[model samples]
Structures are given as structure tokens and as C-alpha cells.
Target: MIKTIIFDFGDVFINLDKPATLRELSQLGDFQFNNSIQDLNNQYEVGKITTEEFIRSYHNLLPQATEQQLIEAWNAILLDFPKYRLDFVKHLAATGDYKLILLSNTNELHINWIKQHISFYEEFKSCFDSFYLSHEIQYRKPNSDIFEFVLQEHQIQPTETLFVDDTKENTDAAQKLGVHIWNNNPKADDVIDLFTSKSDLF
Candidate 1:
């Protein structure tokens, strides 16, 4: 029986435009901004660099742009966290039918942004039995090791844990570990709809 649900924060709970930062950076530079932005993102995820360092690297690259402008542009990807999702997740937690866990691949700046902007961040997080952030864990998803780490830490049977993520690759990785998963595409289907549809199973 599935006794736990693992959720990916960005795109799943909190909406994020994965490419918005790079798109904004593209507007600031003359050359193609694709590869460099990706490299910076990878470095940030792997804990090889800090958010300040990442922002400064980009700012230095685009000397014409002010630091505040670059920061705002980078943060634009984190748009809004809807109240409905929080209420839904809270409902799931309130039922006491399953253990809730949040596993997200994020860094300091994004976290600080959420803490400042989302009024319910603390309450929403409190609903979870465990909250794992990649930066704090020093590991990110789509990496099998991180998935294995969570399974071991929680003592959760892979088959009894459902992993929901917005990215196919991440979900696929978890699925390989024998965990049930849902690839939640925000544009195609909201997570609320998925939860509602799967209510009978729960």
C-alpha cells in the first residue's frame, strides 16, 4: 500500500518557468545565451557555486545591466504560489492517510524568494513529514543517488511511495527506483486535477 507521497516543489506546488531566467538573460546579451546559462544553472544545483556568485557571474557578463535588474530578472521565473494547491495539500495531510514529503531541487536565492513572497510557505512546509532541499542535501534529482538517499533516510518502501514531479526525467529516475510517479505538466493539467482524479485510489 502507498503510505507516502513525495512532491517536487517547483512547478508542482510553486509555479516556475524553468526557462524564463535564461530567456531574460538572452535579451541582455548579444551572443547566444543558451549554453552558458545552463552551465551556471548546473553549477548552482550541484552546490559548486552560491546564488550571489551566480548572479555576479551573470552581472559581470552583462556589464550593461544593473545588479538589481539582473537579480529581478533571474527571480522572475518564480511567479506565484496559488492558495488552492496549499489547501489541497493541507487536505491530504489533514486526512492522516499518508505521510507527506517534499523533495525539491533548489538553491538559496529561490528559497529566500519563496520565504519572502509566499505567506503560507511555513504552514505548507509544516504539513510535510520531511522537507528535503537539494542544496542542503548536496544532491539534485535525475541523479539516482539522491533518490536512493531519500528512500534510505525515510525508510520508505519504494513501491509504497509516490513521487510527483513536473519534469519527466526526474519522475523517470524515481520510477526506476520502483516508486510510483506522476509527471505533472502545469500547462496540460494542474496538480489539483491529478490529485482529485486519483482521490479514489487514496
Candidate 2:
């Protein structure tokens, strides 16, 4: 009875080195991933700050790092979008069996980089019935509002919807709202195995 699938963009589809950003930033002189930076990132993810403001704020914090360097480090977390994953989703979309939606907590810089680097980005996007980016939507995962928004926007029954996210916090949040979930482990889990992996739901 699962009529809809909500997918997380990072890790679930694209490869991300979650710690890579901080690892790259540590190369900059005396840089620390502190609470202020974390708060700034959260704000940026929800579109509270513009990309220029985000870079400028980081540059202010780490005076030793140039804006371009900061941008490069920030984008280090994004690695690659595999062709097979794109093919899988595209095939799924072609069947029109379920409502496909993409929900990701990402920022402008990250998406801009994908558009530039991932040649099939547009094709990948077309696979989804609705694409919701945290920054663009002014909401983020692991929060009730974003989940509620998606559910209400689509008029999808929680019992008939499955949310797949690499982050447990996000899946847990959706689960609380009665949605079925797959807390996928990116290392061992491939989204293309959706039917076999979560066969009980389908």
C-alpha cells in the first residue's frame, strides 16, 4: 500500500563524505568547527542566509581562509552521483507506480555545485514528482514542520508513504508522524535495491 516514496538526496542518492567538509576546513589555520559555525550552517540550510552572507560569515570567522577556499571546503562533502542510481530512479519514475519526491536539507552552494558538476542533474530532477530543498523551502529534516508540509502538500497518507533517509534523526521524526521509513545505511545500502530491501512495505 505504499503509494509514495520520499527520498533524501545526500547519501541516499549522491555520495557524501559527511566529515570531509570539516576535514578540509581544518587545513585552514586555526579553524575549529564550533557551535557558532554549526548554528550558521543550520540557518543557511533553511535559507535564512544568502550564499554571499554564508561565505562572508565564514571568512570573518577564519580570517586566514579566503572566500573561495571556504566555498571549496564547504562543498567537499559532496562527492559523486552515480549513473546507476540515476538510472534506477529514472526507471522507477517511468513506471509511474508511486509518487516520487526528493526532500533534502541542502544549501545553495551545494546544489549550485551539483548543477555544474553533475551532468545528469536535470534528468535526475525530472524523475521526481516534487523536489523540495531545505534552503529553498525554508525548512529542514528532523523537524516536524518539513515533514508535515510534505505530507499535507501531497495529501499522502502517512500509512501509505515511505520516507528513506540516511540520517536516523530524520527518519525518526517522520516515523513519529506515522510514516513508514527506511533508515538506509549508505555504505551497505543501494537505493536501487528498494524492492528487495524493503519488500515488506511494497
lDDT of each: 0.86, 0.95
TM-scores, each model vs. reference: 0.91, 0.99
lDDT of 2 by residue, 1-202 (tens): 9999999999999999999999988898788777988999999999999999999888887899988899999999999999999999999999999999999998999999999999999999999999999999999989999999999999999999999999999999999999999999999999999899999998
- For model 1, name the residue pairs that clash: none
lDDT of 1 at 179: 90
lDDT, residue 77, candidate 1: 91
Best by lDDT: 2
List candidate 2 stretches off by more than 4 Å.
Answer: none
> Global lDDT for candidate 2?
0.95
Candidate 1 regions with alpha-carbon error over 4 angstroms: 34-36, 199-201
lDDT of 1 by residue, 3-122 (tens): 989999999888888788867867777535668777787788778898789878887788888788777777879989999999988888899999989999888788888999999999
Candidate number achieving the greatest TM-score relative to the actual structure: 2
- True lDDT of residue 181, candidate 2: 96
Report lDDT (Cα) of residue 162, candidate 1: 86
